[model samples]
Target chain A: MSRREQAKEENRARIRASAERIIRTEGIDKLTMRRLAEDAGVSLRTPYNLFGSKTDVLIALLEGAGFDPGDALALRDEQLVMEQLFATLDHIEAFFDSDEKFYREVYGGIMSSAHPDVRSTNVERVVAMCQELMTHAAAKNELQIDTNTRELGRYLGVQLLAVLGMWGAEFLSNQESIRQVRRAWCGILLQHCSNASHRAVDAAYQSVALTGS
Target chain B: MSRREQAKEENRARIRASAERIIRTEGIDKLTMRRLAEDAGVSLRTPYNLFGSKTDVLIALLEGAGFDPGDALALRDEQLVMEQLFATLDHIEAFFDSDEKFYREVYGGIMSSAHPDVRSTNVERVVAMCQELMTHAAAKNELQIDTNTRELGRYLGVQLLAVLGMWGAEFLSNQESIRQVRRAWCGILLQHCSNASHRAVDAAYQSVALTGS
Candidate 1:
C-alpha cells in the first residue's frame, strides 16, 4: 500500500483499539466519540472523519473481530455430527469467553442499533457458520433432513444467537446456556435426524454428561 | 392520593410521554437526558430524578405498553390451543405493529442493557405469559405435555422473544418470523405431545394454510 494509505489504516486501528478498551472498562454507554478521540490521542474531529459515528466505530470493531469457522469445518470429516457441533460451540464460546467484557460490549452495541446493515450482517454471519456445519452433516448422511438442511441451519443459527445474547446479557449463565443448547440439539433436533444420527447424538450427549463438560 | 403525590405522578407521566416521542421520531441514539428534559418542559435533572437513567425511562415505556395477554387468556374455554396461541401472537403483533419505530426502540433498549433486574423481569414476564397459555392447553387436554409445561413455556417464551428481537432489528420480516413461530409450535413442539395432539396440530396447520394467513 502507499504511505498515505498505510498511515490511514494505522490511524484507524489505533482508534478501534481505543474504542475496545473504553467499552471493556466503561461499558458501551461510555464509548463516545470524544472519549475515544481523547484515548486515541487524536483530535475530536478525527473520529468523526474516520468512523462517522459511534455506531459506525462499533460496527467496524465487530467486523474486524468476527470469527471464521475454518477450523470447525476441517473437523467435519473425522468427527460425528454431534461431536463436531459441540466442538464448534466450544470454539465459539471460547472466543467470547476470552474477553467477556468485550463480547458483552460488542453484543450490546449491535443490539442497541437499529441499523439494518449491521444487524443483517451479524445474523448472516451466524447463518453462514451453521450452514457449513449442516452441509457436512448432509454429506455424511448423519441426519435424515426431511426438509432443507439450509433452512434447519438458519433456525439453529438463530437459536444459538439467542442463547449467546442471553448469556452475554447475564440473563442466563454460561452453563445454563450450554445446557439449553444441548437439549435443543439432542432432544429437539435429533427428532428430525435418521435413526443412526439419533443414536450418535444420544451417545454424544451421554459422553459429555459423563465427562462433565 | 394527596395533591402533591398526584402532581408528581403527572410530571412523571409527562416525562415518559416525551421520552417515547423522542425515541419514536429521532431514534434511541438521539435520546439524552438533556433533550428529554427540554422536551418535557422540566428541569435538566428531572429525568434523572424520575427514571435514574435513559434505559430506566425506556424500560418504563416498555412496561407500560407491553401486552397484557388478558384477552387471550380469557378465551381459554372457547378456543383450541392453536387458536389461542395464534390469537395471543396476533395481539403481540398488533401492539408491535401499531408503531413499529417505537416497538423497535423499546426492544433495542431492552436487549442492549445488561442490567440483571431489567433483563430478568423482561424474560420472566414472557415466561409467565406463555405458562398461562400452556396451563390452559393442559386443562382442556388440548395437548399432552411430556415434560414440565413450565420448562416448555420458558423455551417457547424465549423463542418468541428471539423472534420479536429479530423482527424489531429488521433481521427477519414480519411474515417470516410468524411462519417460524408457527413451525416451532406445530412442527417441533408437537413432538413432545401425544399422537392425538399431533393430529390436532397438523389439522390446525392445514386449516391455517387453507385460509392463507
Candidate 2:
C-alpha cells in the first residue's frame, strides 16, 4: 500500500481500538466523537473524518472483531448444518459475552438510530450473514427452503437481531434466549428438511436440552 | 373520585391528546415536554409530572388505541387460533397504518432508550400479547407446541418487534413485512398443529399469497 493509504489504515485501527476501549470501560453513552478523538490522541475532526458517527465507530468495531460470517459459511460439508449454525451463533454470543454492555449499546444504536445510512448498513450486514447461512444450507440440501432463499435469509437474519435485542434488554435469560432462538431456527429447518436431514435435525435439537424458561 | 383527582386526570388526558397530535402532525422528533405543554396549554412541569418522559407518553398513546391483548386473549374459541392471531396482528397493523410515522417514532424511541424500566415494560407488554395468543392456542388444542408456550410466545413477540423495526427502517415493504411475519408464524404453527389443524394452518398460509420478497 502507498504511504498515505497505510497511514490512513493505521489511523483507522487506532481510532477503532480507542473507541472499543471507551465503550468497554465507560459505556456507549460516554464514547462521543470528541471523547474518541481525545482517547485516540487524534484531532477532533479525525473521528468525524474517519467514522461519521458513534454508530459507525461501533460498526467498525464489529467489523474489526473476528466475526466473519463468510468464513463461517464456507464450511460446506465439514460439519452438519445445525452444528455450523450454532457455531456461528456461538461466535456471536462470544462477542456479546466479551462486552455485553458495549454490544447492547451498538445493537440498540443500530436499531434505534434515525439515520438511514446507519440502519441500512447494519441491517445489510445482518442479512448478508443470515443469507450466507441459509444459502449454504439450501445448496447442501440440508434445509428444504422452497421459496426465495433471500427472503428466508432476511427473515432469519432479522429474527437473530430481535433475539439479541431481547437478550440485551434483559427480558430473556441467556439460556432462555439461546433456547428460544434454537427452537425457532430449528423449527424452520425441521419444516423444510428432507427425510435424510430429519434425523440429524431432531438429534441436534435434542442434543442441547435447555430446560429453563 | 375527589375533585382534585378528577382534574388531574382530565389534565393528563388533554396533555396526551395534544402530544399525540404533535406526534402525528409534526413527527416524533418534534415532540418535547415544552412543546407538549404549550400545545396542551398547561405548565411546563405538567408533561413531565403526568408522564415522566416522551416514551411514557407514547406508551400511553398505544394503550389508549384500544389494542388490548387481554381482550384478545379472553376470546375462548370465538375463532380458530390462526384467525385470532391474525386479527390481533391486524389490529396492530391498523394502528401502524393510522399514523405510520408516529408509530415508528414511538417504537424507535422505546427500543433505543437507555432506560431499563422503559425497555422492560415495553418488552413485557409485547411478550404478554404473544403469550396470550400462544396460551389460548394451547388451551383450545389448535396448536401442539412441544416446548414451553411462554418461550414460544416470547419468540413470536420479539419477531414481531423485529419485523416492525425493519418496516420502520424501510428495509421491507408493507406487504413483504406482513407476509414474512405470517409465513414464519404459520410455519411454526404448522409444525406443532394436530392433523385437524394442519389443513387450517396450510389454508391460512396460502390464503395470503404475498408474492414479493
- Pick the lDDT winner: 2
Provide the overall lDDT of each model, using Cα atoms, as 2-decimal numbers: 0.68, 0.70
Off by over 4 Å in 2: A74-83, A132-136, A143-146, A168-170, A173-175, A207-213, B1-6, B143-147, B168-170, B207-213
Looking at candidate 2 chain A, the ten consecutive residues that score lowest on lDDT are A204-213
- Which of the CAPRI classes, incorrect, acceptable, medium or high, describes model 2? acceptable
Candidate that scores best on DockQ: 2
> Which pairs, if any, clash in model 1?
none
RMSD for all candidates, in order, please.
Answer: 5.5, 3.3
How would you encode candidate 2's per-residue C-alpha lDDT over B1-213 as one tens digit per residue? 999989889998998899788977887778888999999999999888888887787778777876555565456565777577776666666767786666666766666565678867766777787877777777777665464567567767766665665675566655566666776666566666666567777776675432233
Please give the TM-score of chain B in predicted model 2: 0.84
Across A1-213, the per-residue lDDT of candidate 1 in tens digits comes to 999989878889999999988887787778888999999999999889988778778868865786554455354466777577777777766776777667766766765564667557767877877767777777777767453677767766766766666675666655556655555555445455666577767764553331211
